[model samples]
Target: MDLKKLEEFILEVGAENIPLGMLTITNNSAAGQPVSMDNIRQTAEIYHSFGIPFFLDACRFSENAWFIKIRDPKYANTPVKDIVLEMCSYADGCTMSAKKDAIVNIGGFIAFRDPELKQKIAQNLIVHEGFLTYGGLSGRDLEAIAVGMHEAVDEDYLNYREAHTRYLGQVLTEAGLPVYMPTGGHAVYVDGGKALPHIPHSQFPAVALGNALYLAGGVRTVEIGSLMFEHVDPQTGEPVYAPLELLRFAIPRRVYTRSHLDYIGESAAICMKEAQAIRGLRVKWAPPVLRHFMAQLEEV
Candidate 1:
């Protein structure tokens, strides 16, 4: 969050009304850009001054630490684990999806302070998740999460993980498509609004490109665009769209090797060349909220 804008909002809305502040490292919605160490510390200070609890949605914490090590000069030589600790030190608590940073197949965990709060969370967990002991996970799953959590911060793993994501971005960029710069931690985002300029954003160009990528080579991708982030005017039934229309190729950790990325690059290159042939999509059916997940769209 931008400190200036935050202060303005706080002043307008009154600080007492604010309950919490949350930050997502390698922000998923921002094409995976890392939240800088400077930004993190300053935001913590601002939130603390306002008596607001600060938290992290640390899904990609490991990848974020890796980005900090390479991108920021002050932490250029800092170890990944130490960086992770320091980053966490600035937050009151965090939520983790093991599927992302920990590389686990399933399950997630929460980190927090305040003993009374912990008890409250445990009580809530029992109501929905299960016994707090293992949250209903098998012993093998628990073991994998424990080991994967540590391995996620390993130096070798961090290097390869970042490199793989960057390589895909480089390849796609070379193919003459617009890719988000400084390649983020987990995926390469193609600016589909630019890639398929002939198809207007109103018609869901990003979704069309994602569908094209899949049909071209059986490669799956997700659209981050108007369809996903748009808001609706309830009274008027007017649709409001997001600013950027992106299509992401999120690479799974330790899954595909060099050849796989090369194949994706070639497929994307073909998609770019044949972009004019692709058609935008219109929502055939949608739910009242969060429509992108299950909405049915047909070619326009």
Candidate 2:
């Protein structure tokens, strides 16, 4: 989603000319969803054509691994550990967000076998972050990350989470609410555009939905819109354009039970049923970057 970060990484890798062979992408998948080995192979081949090494953002490898094993029984005998390692081997390096599949408190890691690249990245990591030895992550957090990574691969855990997501999706869809197709992750996405087609991007649909959900059931969700990109002009001090607003309901793994998810679904249904358009908020310019969060709202 954050293409900026990916572009930066690509630039860094390309600068070294490390023969970056392949880049793996998901096929409309979500967190903890399975991906096919054939998909991976095809992606690798695409990159191989360019004679560059390939790397996958294996944050959801656990789900993909399971999917592959189930879909292709021929690989049933192959251990997930081996499959993941082999996939990683196709790339010179890979990075994963520990907070997702790993389910750690909050952390991330990049792995590579190349001694030179590893050393260089490690040096930069030390200066930018903390020492690789410390990396600002406590030992307890590291242990949790390790354990969570293992737990993420458990069939029961993945199944339960997937079922819960599907249940929520079904509830919202049956209620005639706009919902994205259920994928592997624990979250359910309510399409703000569908929910409020009349409301323009500048009106911030996600923020409106979030506020409505709170008023209805005290539930909180985030907007994945371009609100973060909106900026006021320096001289005239006016917004260039309104940003897209999307509400994201993130479900933490093993936290909320089925009943809780049902409650969320119910709340979403209620909010959508009673949804109203948000009137654009007028902005009064201030020096420097405006803290939208601190801006006072009045029903204009």
Strongest candidate by TM-score: 1
Candidate 1's TM-score: 0.95
Candidate 1, 64-125: lDDT as tens digits: 99989998999988999999999999998999999999999998888886678789899999
* Backbone clashes, candidate 2: 8
Q: What is the C-alpha lDDT of each candidate?
A: 0.90, 0.65
Q: Residue 25 in model 2: shift from native, Å?
A: 6.5
Model 2: CA > 4 A from native: 1-36, 51-53, 67-83, 226-246, 277-300
Candidate 1: worst 10 consecutive residues by lDDT? 109-118
Off by over 4 Å in 1: 233-238
Residue-by-residue lDDT tens digits, candidate 2, 1-300: 233454455567773465564343332223223556766665565555546667777777766666565558878877766666666655667777788789876987887767898888889988898888657788888888889888877877766766777787787677666776644454666677668776666665656677778887898876555343466689998876443354667777778887887787788778767676444333343234544445443333
